[model samples]
Target chain A: MVAAHALTVDDMREVRAAAQGGRFFALFDPNALIAAIARSGDRAAFAELFDHFAPRVKGLLMRGGASAELAEEIAQETLLAVWRKAALFDPTRASASTWIATIARNLRIDIARRETRSRLSQVYEILDEEPPEQPDATLSGAERDARVRAAMTQLSADQYRVVELAFLEGFSHQDVASRLAIPLGTVKSRLRLALSHLRGRLEDLR
Target chain B: MSAVHRPSDETLAAFVAGQLDEGLALVVACHVEADPASRQRLRDLQAVQGALLDAADPVAMASGPRDVRAAGQGSRSPASAPSAPEAGMPQVLRPYGLGPWRSIGIKVAMRRVVVPDAEARVFMLRAGPGIALPHHKHSGLEWATILSGAYEHEYGRYAAGDFDEADSSHVHTPRVDPVEGCTCIVAMTGNVLFQGWLGRLLQPLVRL
Candidate 1:
């Protein structure tokens, strides 16, 4: 009997070779793959799963402002979470990116909670636990891609940099100022103005 | 239309990067949860990240085959992991650090304390009387709350219990009352550009 995940890269060599031939990969369902490997303890499936999703997870974390090292760490943690809870990969619920994004979000929350406990009394604790439920009339991935690109294009270089540093590097204004050797006021103004600009761009998209 | 308080560029960036500490992230997340306009901005930035990922050149995977290894052993369940309330206080303080104090040029002390994996640092400032912090602008968002004593900013006077958030476009000089001395906590992202001579001289030491 053929093992559920016995196919190796060698076995899929024809497909890998065809990856360069403008041939589309079969619409492999990530959830089914995750389930199959998960139930059978198939390492090959796990490796394939990691290879396909790790890059995107890294991308999301980096975009969210994690450093390359931090992003790698989060990505690893996310996959481990996936491995541990592979049964939770309900394809009907969300795409892998969305699910992974949710994982990143939760981990982010866990980290934030742990870090800011000392000053707890000073600031009101506001937990954002609501999942990013896909809206009933949500746009397709391609539409989202177009809309987001259009919105991003409108920000100024400085604004874009501020956004990138804040989200991608996770630098606070003071941290950003310290790193760039600028004044606190300047950092604040740039970020403020950048957000306003981003808002305007988004308004245009809507 | 509840003021549609948009997150400062830095705040948005930090949120996207998953760097803001828990307390602050919660604060911002609460705001985002209530504000749809703000949520749109977040989605836009996330998409930008997706595009960047789509655009980057593919890195080659490791070559040469290896023996097919068995799947790793299963991990412990959530119930097995130590609970949060059980981890003690330091785990709680993992997001905000006990920062160091440094001179802020005019008899003021300032330092950015590090918390592991945080995108932003917590700022603790202690300034004596007659110290006017340099004229500067923000690169991202800033949240400042007074802890002790009092200080006057261009916008208005702030005492204890008053929390203020400044977007990237605001500029100001903070003058402290020496008799009481001022200690405040601020969360900020992005760089600052100092305006004058003293600012230039102290630029290296007081980058934040």
Candidate 2:
């Protein structure tokens, strides 16, 4: 499987020290791979994650309006950030993909502005420290992703449109209203209703 | 279910999408950092964002994993937290530039705090113990979070880590708590207009 592709002696020092070192039959679980990277700075696992996610992130960034070159650069930066911040990944709080998406979002903002993003996380990155992790009881990344996808499909077309504009494409409520030729109240209500429905479906995690 | 004033769900959604202006995001970040419930909400919503990303059509990258890995080498630098200038100030605001505190009214003082990329003017408002400010109404959005001590308006008392939002529709005089006084970070969009005779008297001389 994916684990088999990572057994090569990429980093001689980390061969047996990593979780992926001898487990040829091990599944390519992103969370487990991330833990292995954090546990031993596993390059192979990082490579696997990058291979699995970079193109996806690049595509997503392009969809969000980044140029191909910028999207490619941002995707690479996102993964590098992933490698750097693997230790901060909390599976219970957010899945690897979700965390990666957050990283990508931060990078896209920074890259778009072409400046040092004053986002708190950037400062934390400079400080090389994060606030103490708070304990959270929630679904794992994959399960949460599945649930969110299921919930999104249940939204009405109008509600989904609002979500796509307000969330996926990062439109403001006023902008979403203008884009759809709908009233501001309708945009806000649709967003509220959609988020509530998705939030209700996600309540089992609590 | 009960908590101090927090940003609305729509606002949080915008924050999650990286769509909020920097000043508003900072205020919300303070609230989210202080409140675990909001933090969880942010994560839950981000997962949905991740799902949306997953559905995007894949594009081929010009560079491969090896190229990314190679480029990432030697990019890691040691990160150190800046020495905090004031106690009880939220960590999110510790990195930006801050100006000296300036006295404006009898007990109220204001200081400029720069938030990079912020459209709204950000500042720190510190008041002496048990002082009542003149009643004023806002023109645009105003977000204030207590960093130290407490303040009470018509709405309620807000202590450390408490967030208060006032729009043009919100008008009230905020009185600092007697014992602790108050220090709050405020991000305001428009001017604050005084409510009474003070409106015509101090409106020109006093600045918030």
Candidate 3:
């Protein structure tokens, strides 16, 4: 039985390896995969998405200071959420990657907050039990995304660093300051400038 | 819509990253509901985050359950219509199960929201026209979003859709406009420390 299980694991690994190689040829479009899952509970489409996003989500959570085990758990949960919320995905509003990233971030936050609440229940009383749900925003088109991407390249090195630390690593302002060995005020100003520049470049979309 | 006071970029970014505490996020959610411009900003920020996700280096996931067939079977669809808020209540605050409003001062009433994981005390405060709240400073973060009417503090006038964020460093005494009473949802992290003789005298009587 143990030998059979090992053989099954090896077969799965081979399948995944083949899928990874296929990425170079077909360049899987997450948007189309999401649409497939939404229209019909397409297991193949979901497998493709799971293969591509699960690991990236895990990496992001790990970078945000979660333990490896916790990160993996959240990553799986994030994909589960994507599957559950697929019908709500309006491709025109957001790309699949962005939507999935949000699910991962929110799950991590929920877990962290729950732990904190349990630890500090005696000192701090939280009255509301429900988590805050993300608002559905209408995202711009692909053209706007390209423009915003172009605008990002125009940010100063310092500004980009702040944005990277804050957004990608989920660092707080103080965390960014201490990580970069800069004053807290400096971190704040740099981040503010970066956001303002990006907003200005994308204002025409509005 | 243009006049609606939006949260700062940092706060909004924090909201996008899911880093803001639940209480503060709720206030931002309320603002986003009333203001389309802020919602647009949120989308823009989220798109940027999406691009970041795309650029991230992929890590190899460990082999696990390969069954994707029953993945979402037990999950409810997200297409269902959001339940309508109680009459005269904002949709964002409907989920909290607010308590009965009790008189906190003359022509002023407040109701506490039951948020289980929040370090902050979330509540709704309503003041009659021309009523003035005693001057006070917060021990930590204090976030208030105006629901209706307008109030003027030392900082400036805050009207409907305005989100006022304050910390321990700031102090203000707000007065409602005489023409219209003001109602606000507030999430406070720490106790309020009243300033001056009158404020100190009233502080003991004030439960919030």
* Tens-place lDDT digits, model 1, residues A57-124: 66655554556676666666666666666765544333445455555555544444555433331211
Which candidate number maximizes DockQ? 2
Scored against the true structure, residue A62 in model 2 reaches a CA lDDT of 77
True contacts kept of each: 0.21, 0.54, 0.39
- Which regions in candidate 3 have their CA more than 4 angstroms from the true location? A1-24, A115-141, A168-170, B64-66, B73-84, B191-208
Q: Looking at model 1 chain A, report the run of 10 residues with the lowest lDDT sum.
A: A121-130
Can you give the lDDT of residue A127 in candidate 3?
12
**Error of model 3, residue B127, in angstroms:** 0.5
DockQ of each: 0.16, 0.41, 0.26
lDDT over C-alpha atoms for residue A100 of model 2? 86
- Candidate number with the higher TM-score (1 or 2): 2
Q: Could you give candidate 2's per-residue lDDT for residues A69-168 as a string of tens digits?
A: 9999989888888887777777755667778888788777777756745554554243223332343565665677788889999999999888877875
Listed in order, each prediction's TM-score against the native is: 0.47, 0.80, 0.82
**Top-down TM-score ranking:** 3, 2, 1
- Model 2 residue runs over 4 Å out of place are A1-28, A35-44, A116-150, A168-170, B66-85, B191-208
Model 3 over residues A108-184: C-alpha lDDT tens digits?
76566665542221111111112213333334445446666778889998997788778854588999999999999
Reference-based lDDT, each prediction = 0.54, 0.73, 0.70
Backbone clash count for every predicted candidate, in the order shown: 54, 4, 6
Which residue segments of model 1 deviate by more than 4 Å? Answer: A1-46, A55-73, A83-145, A153-161, A173-197, B1-6, B33-45, B48-208
lDDT of 3 by residue, B40-94 (tens): 7776787777777766666667765356666655344332224566786666665
